[model samples]
Target: MIPKESRNELALDTFIKAHPHLLEEMKELSAEDRQQQILWAFEDEAESRGLEAWELALELIAR
Candidate 1:
């Protein structure tokens, strides 16, 4: 089984790959800041859909 941290990273990677426009919008930030922005955006999106962030991450990676 994958470690939980690894799973989360995979989920985030999957999320980023599926949304290239997000990367385009954050091109000016440092890499760390860009990742933080993406994480917050992902969480916000999940909240808007009434699901926990992990659930959205899972759904993204599953696709």
Candidate 2:
């Protein structure tokens, strides 16, 4: 099985790739701000879809 940390990393990567518009939006921010925004957006998206943040990340990786 994948290590938990690695799984989360992969999930985040998959999530980012699936949302190219996020990258575009992030480009307007400083590195730290971009990181924060991405995390917030990720969490918001997961919540909107009725899944826990990590659950949505893993689901994205699965796809």
* Per-candidate local distance difference test: 0.88, 0.85
Candidate 1: regions farther than 4 A off: none
| Positional deviation of residue 50's Cα in model 1 after best superposition, in angstroms | 1.0
Q: Residue by residue across 21-59, what tens digits does model 1's lDDT show?
A: 999999999999999999998888889999999898778
lDDT of 1 at 5: 87
lDDT of 2 at 46: 94
lDDT for model 2, please. 0.85
Model 2 misplaced stretches (Cα beyond 4 Å):
none
lDDT of 2 at 43: 92
lDDT of 1: 0.88
Backbone clashes in model 1, listed as residue pairs: none
